[model samples]
Target: MSTPALTLQGLGKSFGDVRALHDVDVTVESGTVHCVLGENGAGKSTLCNLVFGGYRPDAGRMLLGGNEFHPDSPAAAMAAGVAMVHQHFSLVTTMTVAENLLLTQHGLRMRRRDLTDRLDEIAQRYRLRVDLDQRVATMPVGARQKVEIVKALLREPSLILLDEPTGVLDPAEIDALIDTCRAVAADGTAVVLVTHKLGEVARVADAATVLRRGTVAGGGRMSKTSIAELLTAMVGRTAADLDPTVAATLGLDTAGPRAAARQRHSTALDATAPVLSVEGLCAERADGSTALAQARLAVRPGEIVGIAGVEGNGQSELVAILAGSASATGGTVTLDGTDITAARPATRTELGLGVVPEDRHRDGMVAGMTIAENLFLGQLGRFRRFGLLDRRAIGRAAQAELDRFDVRASGPWVRMGSLSGGNQQKVVLARELSATNLRCLVAAQPTRGLDIGAVDFVLTQLRRAATEGCGVLVVSSEVPELLALCDRVFVAYRGALTGPVETADLTAAQQISELMMGVAA
Candidate 1:
């Protein structure tokens, strides 16, 4: 064929003792989407980094359009017609979108009006709309992502790499992004999509490559390769090898039967009084700006309620209010008919409230502490005997929790930081759900940055918690997860709520999407 747009042969990279990628090979043809599929630590990031000239490969070589490509820096990569949109944004938050985009060009003076005009033209041409005057810090996550994409598109690169671009976008935005990618590819630019989201792969990929533990697992043309095969390659196991519940959740098994069963569960939940209720809730951010206003929702016992929104739209503040970490400026929070608006976090916990904070590393655990210590962080008094801590009892209890939760770690004695992201999440889930009197759970982005198996596990746990009669409030940007797990879904936009849409409704996705954009009530 014509020279491949990009090629990697026996690519290998390492970080001291960790082999991030090994003998990895991939090829991207002109005007096509090449997907790099893998789990959290599966070297997908390393491979992309190598292509972007962020890290020099430890072995093998890369070719760009029949030429040897060894870029020493990102600037060199850009000059060679390669662009990358990183998972975490690289924009200067204090700068305006136009200013940030202008910085990408070399030898360009700081001319705001000229840059804004150029940006507007590029945005119009690419069907990517971004306000040139908007500060990066003030824009929502989806808007920021558009800015990133537009930044890349403005470069007019022959090859563009997008890393987990959909993680922060709503469904409508995701569809728009996919369309944008297709349009870009249609223009003869090769695209590399690095994502763990299977739906995205199925929708956009022309060719797919699976990476498992730093090695190529399997890959083929997207149309010919079944999702089951891709899943097997990613996890190193067949569908039958997965936990049946997880398999069912991932839709590897028929969902028709599961839907009927869940419908019954939902019906039962509908008959009960709300276990947790928030009315006219208002909250302020750390900067004293209104983060939540007149937000109201209720979660019945044995039900899962979802708060869906784009990031920076008061979802975080609402979760904080429920978790008792932030004060509500105007509104009431009630748990099982008892007012908890004025209660401290510890008191809320005592009153049967469990919270899984969004930033697990910062709020969920003490990284330096042992798993046992982190597991029993707040309730260490139970392990006290004769005025001294009972280490043996604590260890034993911790091990049981770890085993029960299926947290894959060396042992309970291992430091919390030593476990993977998934395992750390399990510790949080186990601690929260296993509370003796847990009546309500506030889980914020519970599966963020987790692998497929880990996501399945977390969802299973949340469903199990609901089945055990715990009212769950899941605050997430992931629409699929919300749709799959929540009995009723509510959309949060600009500190307001619109929805309580039944999951069984055929128009749920569209309705939710409209609400998410603050378009429909």
Candidate 2:
């Protein structure tokens, strides 16, 4: 028989008494994507870690090209044709793209120019464009992730694993990565993708495996299985029970219960004066490139307005400037008629401006801290008694908020990083929305990596915020999300802004697609 790319037989793993995975079996063939699906603690990571040599299995064996295979470390695994790109990056912050890629292989010496040319060639073959001279620290999170994928592809591994790759990327970049994966798989490599997005699986995966509570639940060939069947297997719930918008995203027939619920809570919008407004707002990237130019928009009380565009087209810079992480070179931004263009983040917060950053872990909260501590960061005074923080008070309130947000965690004492992406986002939202004085919110890619349930909950929370008269400005890479949730949307392209176009008027999907790609009205 011809050898398969990889095969696992009855894999099992345990940490003390906690069985992370058991009797998990999967086979990957040459030139195909095999997706792993599950909720946060479904042993997807355990399986990926075992394959990449981050952990050793307590039971079962692996065969690589029909031969027994075992590796002691990640480096060893890479040497044996198993390459992995982690959800978090591993590139040096101070290095340039070329410098980082050149360091991929150790003890191999070559002229810098020659190696760069070869790297460029590989990147071109995959159609991934990287700014060779750009420093890692200066690039956006999405750009950095692209570089990591390219680094993994450069190794020419027979098996490649990508963990939650699309979380930080825009739609265009995600599409490009999917294309790249197909190209590599066509070259006879096996691709294992661990993802929460079913739509993406529909787009890229040839076959799938669903993990539930450390065991294989169900999965099948994409050509043979329906999306409804896949969703039911992964989540163990009927589509009718899901939020309308969530169901819509999964290509299911959707109802309007979520929207109807929001409507029940909503008061009439006061559009005479905006709670947040921007006029001719201009900003520059860290490298002095124009990031935003002549931007104009407004969010009325009890309204959610969104900005949609391809990544790297001023969205990040606009959010950064508004959040007070970066300075605007020109123009003005006002929160409730009070100019805040020069306000610090803390000052903005004090002025009732809450922000949910684009990359939640990196900018929204400290991962190493407990959820309670993270929730009250810079506001310990609320729970302070006699100049000491009241731990019991904080824990009680934090737990209540977590429960309200449907955050699945042991308790408020758990480390923020220990929670899944969706749960982390819930915690972030809990902190920001709980503020008694919150007047406006700026959410950047708020639902970036969450599962369907989490996305529904978060969007519901956003609607609830609007219902309570908190003006909202959402910056997103997905046009459909904006169209579904926002009252209106603005299209950004090449750092230029256009719109305030009502989603109701923008009925055709192609019209919005054209606008997103910078087509003239």
* Candidate whose lDDT is highest: 1
TM-score between model 1 and native: 0.84
Which pairs of residues collide in candidate 1?
none
Could you give candidate 1's per-residue lDDT for residues 282-360 as a string of tens digits? Answer: 9888677889889899888988888888777888888888888788889999999999998999999999999999888
Worst 10 residues of 1 by lDDT: 249-258
**CA lDDT, every model vs. true structure:** 0.84, 0.83
Global CA lDDT computed for model 2:
0.83
For residues 132-165, write the lDDT of model 2, one tens digit per residue: 8899998877789888888887777899999888
> After aligning candidate 1 to the native by TM-score, how far in Å is the CA of 520 from where it should be?
6.9
Candidate 1: Cα lDDT at 94: 99
The positional error of residue 183 in candidate 1, measured at the CA in angstroms, is 2.4
Which segments of model 1 are wrong by more than 4 Å?
72-76, 102-114, 236-273, 283-293, 309-314, 359-403, 408-421, 477-480, 493-499, 504-520
